[model samples]
Target chain A: MKLKQLEGLLGNLDQFSAPKIELEQYPTGPHIASRMLYTAENSFEDVSDKVVADFGCGCGTLGIAAALLGADHVIGFDVDADSLEIAYLNAEDLELDVNFVQSDIRNLQCRGKIIDTVVMNPPFGTRNKGVDMDFLSVALKVASQAVYSLHKTTTREYVKKTALREYNAKSAEVLCELRYDVPKLYKFHKKKEVDIAVDLWRFVPTPTVESDV
Target chain B: MRLLTHNMLSSTIKGVSNGFPLTIEAAKVVEKQVDMNSDFLKNIFSKIEWKPFVEAAKTLGFSELPEEDVQPSLLDSHEFLTKFHHALLEIHLEEGALVCPETGRKFPVNKGIPNMLLLEDEV
Candidate 1:
């Protein structure tokens, strides 16, 4: 999609909700912050001949970006019907083909097929019950390479330990951070602060299958 | 199960602290073709956690990924999106256990599907 078109889409919204399965949604304006999109876009520059998946595809931003950035194919999954509707509209508008499925991230079923890359900005643990780790674990299981955005304060340690223990994946901290400034007038806005610190991780499966042995 | 589902699941037992990536010990796996919608994906980019998704794909034995910091072009061509769709939606773990790293909790998969059920003792 052209930058101009994207800008138009971004500008056309007054309030945008995240894909429904997530605990919360962005109150107004494009649900995603433009800066975050730019950051993610830049992050996938070298991806090629790879299948990419965008989990919790609120409005299909990441998947669209992946296609634009040269991913061989992109599939997006979300649980919200309304969000999926908007996501579909956005994909159509951009003239980029994407696969958007309506399903909970927890119970997703993709038989034997594998993708080269996966990307997501899962619910920040702080929003509801602080269980974002569940989202991270699943992402690790389905993609060869993955990128995750999380709260800067708590996610680093948790992500590190999980990556090491589960898939034996190695991680590197990217120097990028996203901060959202919420206007103070709202009841929940006691000066909202979201520190977006992302970790880039890669998994190399152990040669445990007997075929190699 | 899709990597997206694996990420949100936990051992659900009473005190399992880390249940992030449910390990798949699949006894049977299957794949299916699903429809595509590009506009929907474009709108939901921020909600994805890319790193773990990549890790999960690798575990399944796929290793082609773009480098970090590249811009995805929506208008590049149809060929690119078609290939991406196959990897992201078609891959399936028919049977497997999503083992938790912190608690050693195991969620089993039967018949190309993962059973994320937790026992009362686990909860």
Candidate 2:
């Protein structure tokens, strides 16, 4: 399927009702998710036959696309039970063989599984500073290959710098610019749909050195 | 919880390092025949961890899989593919408990959903 075709399919999935503030739950727009998945499919490493994860998967947009694109297996991780209910329903509706795991990604554990790639739209840390980095920190450690994380367009340089200095990242690149619509969930959002700048950042996760080996 | 999901699940609670291949205790098992996609099955063969697949299959009472791992060449066999398809996609655990190997924590599976929520203290 073409990029837009994927977006059309993902666009049909259910969305959140009242997203929690602490989670900073903003679903990745269908267009961005489709384009990112497409790029990942055609770019460096194809998600096909790879164990792909969608961390902070609110209703499983990225992960479902990976499954649709023929990822060997897809797992959607989220802390909220309510979000997971909708995600499971989406997967069931699509008849896709994907699983939703309810857990805080930071504290979640997957022993012995080597995740080939991670596609996630984590919290940008708008309400809570450094929350985005927290997602990156865990993604770097858990993922064996690379992480495709979405960040605010303005923080591209800061994100790239930190990935290099902190994780000794092998490589980092700004894959694409995505125009996200921040839905008015809280009292703060004035407009019904507000367009914002978001960048899809791909990073080669470097596991911390283990001297015990 | 299907074995495909079970294959990827681990207990990621803080302090527990070895949280892989959680043991399954099925209170309910449902069989739903999803259309077979040979192309997808062919691609995912190599990615499947043979031991975990066999172990999980055994727990779910579908022990028809071979004791030894089938190689990449087995992807060509119709019988193998059919069996693989059944084991991977058809079998489903509507209710169960995925037990953490190290922590022995029970993650409940209700109505085919596995709840992996960790307690506040656990996190």
Model 1 regions more than 4 Å off = A1-22, A27-46, A181-187, A191-213, B1-123
Stretches of candidate 2 exceeding 4 Å from the true structure: A206-213, B14-17, B32-50, B68-81
* TM-score for each model: 0.52, 0.86
Point to the candidate with the largest lDDT: 2
Q: What tens digits encode model 2's per-residue C-alpha lDDT throughout B1-123?
A: 668777767776677877776889988888877667788777656656778788888888899888685788888888988888888877888888999889899999987778888887777
lDDT by residue (A1-213, candidate 2, tens digit) is 788889999999998988888889888779888888888988866587677889989999999999888786678888888998988898889988787777777775454335678889989998889878878877776676788989999998899898888867788899888898887888878788899899888888665453110
Q: In model 2, what is the error at residue B94, expressed in angstroms?
A: 2.1
Point out the worst 10-residue segment of candidate 2 chain A by lDDT: A204-213
Q: Pick by DockQ: which candidate is best? A: 2
Which of the CAPRI classes, incorrect, acceptable, medium or high, describes model 1?
Answer: incorrect
Q: Write the per-residue lDDT of candidate 1 for residues A88-202, one digit (tens) a residue.
A: 6776676655656555666553432344466666666666654456666666655555554444444666666666686455554544444443334335655555334344333
Chain B TM-score of predicted candidate 2 relative to the true chain B: 0.95
What is the Cα-based lDDT of residue A44 in candidate 1? 49
